[model samples]
Target: MSNESPLIQSMRTAVAAAPADVPLRLHLAELLLGEGLGEAAVAEAAVALQHAPGDAGARALMMRAMGLPTPADDKAEKAEKPEEPAAPGPSAGFDWAAAENEVAGAVPPRFVTPARAAGPGVGAPEAPLAADGSGDPGDATAWEVDTPGSVTLADVGGMQEIKERLEAAFLAPMRNPELGRLYGKSLRGGLLMYGPPGCGKTFIARAVAGELGASFMSVSINDVLDMWMGNSERNMHEVFETARRQAPCVLFLDEVDALGAKRSRMQHGGMRNTVNQLLTELDGVGGANEGVFVLAATNVPWDVDIALRRPGRLDRTLLVLPPDAPAREAILRYHLRDRPIESVDLGKLVKVTEDLSGADLAHVCESASERALLDSTRTGVVRMINMKDLLGAAKEVRPSTDPWFASARNVAMFANEGGMYDELLAYLKRKRKL
Candidate 1:
């Protein structure tokens, strides 16, 4: 007869059945520890550590079995060390800061330190170079601009719906300065473009700038965020200040959700402060952002701070969806323009590439060219890209936007407030995707 108790026998059986299950092994180790079987618990914990070397639980349990201080005890000792530094020998002369640095190497970093600007010492405020190659931090004219963008709405192939919406909501007022002044409409409001990744939101922003005959200044999250306290807020201020100086400029904030995520969901005060700074800049408190037209884009607008969408801020929203048939045809032609093609039927190609984003379409073209190149190499005969290659590539490449829409559908249905996602809901319904 087995000498082990029912609980011990059952746990042994369970561990045998799930030999690779580290958590199950840890549970058994805990039970052994409770029963005062220190040796058995140490063996089990050692095995668990072998499976998950980085697991703090296994390490803590092992330390306990060895009659050593657990991580928690170490932390407690460290906390109370100043008053009673002679409690434990290991911690008596322990370098807590050095230990913390070592642990940080194993964990993912929270932030990266910014490189110091030219002519600044180690602790000086880091400033990025201006577009004019000047290191002057105060020169707002250092803001880079793609002056007189060549891509107008006319260059955008077939997003007629987007064009019309832009005209009525954004472009018309800006174009007719006299009417805008008469109606007391300020040229400082923001427009937020949102959709799946790579649906040409950035391209559309450039087109909008072109339509307004203005310069374009694109800003990403990296351009604004800084590791130093108060530096991130200052960086954001500089971005807006530069835009304001370069009036009639489109200040395009790409991936704005990262820069302005909802404060309620943020765990850190620093992130919340960054969002607040963004709001202040958007409001232009001192009329400092008079002619700078703010335009922001995000794949996940639901993550963006609600305060950013207020009336005078990024109040207006536009959905940049996947390309329609005409747009797809245009994208195909553009990608294949340099490639050798034989009798490519764009109509047939567009029909088959339904729901593909502009980026997906580009990938399809590249894949088709690669396929043709591979075939020519194998057969030792150079041949042009054909419909077969294109269609085959199209069949292999799935629409990247599908996953984005899947997530958006849930947000649109559940968390939508004040008809914020009405356009998204309508699109889903029209496409019978709801």
Candidate 2:
């Protein structure tokens, strides 16, 4: 009873007043140890250590109060004994007060937000990017499909204007920080990348992250859907939390309509609930503001929630379309950049690829290369792709946008006042190229 001095009593009183203040406890514990009150020191230090196991100073007080050697000396002694391992008990609980720098290494089967409950690292709850569409951690390593940076603007075919816009929006500002400040705009929040399928929507999203030196976290519709409403809300909150921590990062979403279909069309309670919850989490201040961006790609841009497209949410929408002739030619050079081509004229080839999308041209070039290299031990090699091989490939593969172009042409033709499809007049003129 005499061991309880006035100073120790004061320390206990202060700690009692703010029991949740882990930092204050550690400070009291360290002060007690400094004054040689080892017994009282150990008690305070032990309790403080419970809140934050990683604090080296608090840990040292515990060791001194327990009448044990310093941690360094103890580890050294243990190292001297080749046969014995240190009896370091299982880790105590983790302290989320210092929630920064905590990384959730791998995907968990299901995730719970760390704000309300302490759990292992979360893969970031914000933008779920699972392509197979399950969205959750079904497979152990099911987060992002392709690594960032691999798909450069050059890697993507066509969409040069879109590329130019992205370069100005994301790249130029990031690569030149001072210049960004001078221009008075920092890259933050959301950029909606919407386009047709296989037109490099996903590629451009990933490339933006890569070009900006940001981490990529993705989420899809399937990942956010929960049988229970409250669970989904919590999950959405957790995601934005994780995303802010992993700042200067891109949250890419593919086929976003699946997750953010027009709210008006949602028939089920689950769908509407999830969309509203998502809108709040993304558009609200509950999420981080600095360098945490959302890039959602969908074919059905018309179906995306309007709230998402409003000013601050997913404000910037870039329409990714099929490559025009010059773009198609660039795309051809890119896909065929590694492969060897015969004395076929690129200008002539470009002319023949009129009305074909970048994806369509890629398929044609790929088939041509495969056919050219099929005879030798060159499995999948393209040593000498000739004009005949390319023409043959054109016959084998069909244009993806043929039907769309036809409809567009008819619409433009009927709508035009002059006897011409004013908008598609250029494309109509190029019909002879194909």
Candidate 3:
């Protein structure tokens, strides 16, 4: 905790106080590199590059921090063609090249390749190394599977109702197999989480995986779709098959509405076939899915195929609303944990962000940090993020969920067949949106 010298600490404080100060950030990065803190130096350099991508000093410092040689020609080229000035904001200006190089060694390849490849006249055709499918036998690399994370329901702050519902609908059955069997409760169905965008549906899905101590594989439309005929269906099959192989796995289908949209409304036969393949996989036609748990999430559940919601598939639904007061406070605190913030009235801030989703809360924090950084940069006086900055940002950020709720209102009121969206309806009514 006390390993850093006083000067290093002071530099960190200054950088946090004036995040837009490219020279100061570069200087801090240089100091960290001199102190043998390579990783820390790389992080500082990365931030500096984001603020000023064309800075020669920052670029050289980044190369040194990463233990890479800075070529003379590369430096000359950088000088000749300066990078475009990034957007003016705290979280703007992502330096993709620097970021990729920084994590190139640490992160594994997205797809696995065969060791030996056939000559020019390859057997048939080289398999596509798409993120969704590499077509390698028994290779699950195509669909990134995260190990059981440490984030459990306990880590999800102020969602007591969500935790309890999850326990009753999903977690309890998995936890007590004997009890479930005694009560004729079959673990053959999946849970569908539906709500406005920016809620923590995906996070909750991951938490469910963590609770079950299972591997987590998240699939989205982009991960499944392919231009070639039938490739999409194959990708979907591969995804489920990978989950089956990695028994005790949670296969999370993000944006299920897009993947399983109503077949009647589909203009393409391929998407219909993809949905059919998904249904087959969910039914485990080829192999038993005994230990594979399915969790799907969507913002517009009404658009999902009706057949997918039938019994023994994604039959159960849970509505995830915006963060409550306590949840908002927790989210704000987490976002501000590393920033140079002082005298923040979290309780007051929470009261003002009543309908803000988790993402919106993050934006508020970013905006507040930007204000403080810009103010410091203009006035030449470094300062910590104060309550005024936070409150102003909160006032500026309209709740992003408002539009989602607006669209959902008509659906919840009119098309709630079989009371599928009763939870949503109740929420709208309570909020006086009905």
Best by lDDT: 1
TM-score winner, 2 or 3: 3
Candidate number achieving the greatest TM-score relative to the actual structure = 3
Candidate 2 lDDT over residue span 1-434, tens digit each: 36666776787789999986888887787777677776666667656655664678876666666666896888999889789666765586556544433443432212122244456874332321211111112211224333344444554444557778887765676677677678876556677775445566665666677677777777776556678757766666666666666777777766777777787887887777777877876764643556777888876655677788777788776766666665665666656655766565566677787656666777887788657644221231214567788878877776786665555555555554333234244545656421
- Deviation in angstroms for 153 in model 2? 3.4
- Of 1 and 3, the candidate ranking higher by TM-score: 3
When superposed on Cα atoms, how far off is each prediction in RMSD?
21.5, 25.1, 19.2
lDDT of 1 by residue, 113-227 (tens): 3455645465523221111101111211324666766667877778889999999998998888788789988767699999998678877887788789987888887887889
Model 1 accuracy (lDDT, Cα): 0.80
Kindly give the stretch of ten consecutive residues in candidate 2 with the minimal lDDT sum: 131-140
Candidate 3 per-residue lDDT over residues 18-37, each given as its tens digit: 99999898888888888888
lDDT of each: 0.80, 0.63, 0.79
- TM-scores of the models, in the given order? 0.67, 0.54, 0.70
Candidate 3, residue 422: Cα displacement in angstroms equals 1.3
User: What shift in Å separates residue 171 of candidate 2 from its native position after superposition?
Assistant: 4.7
The pairs that clash in candidate 3 are none
Q: How far does residue 231 in candidate 2 sit from its true spot (Å)?
A: 4.6
TM-score preference between candidates 1 and 2, better one = 1
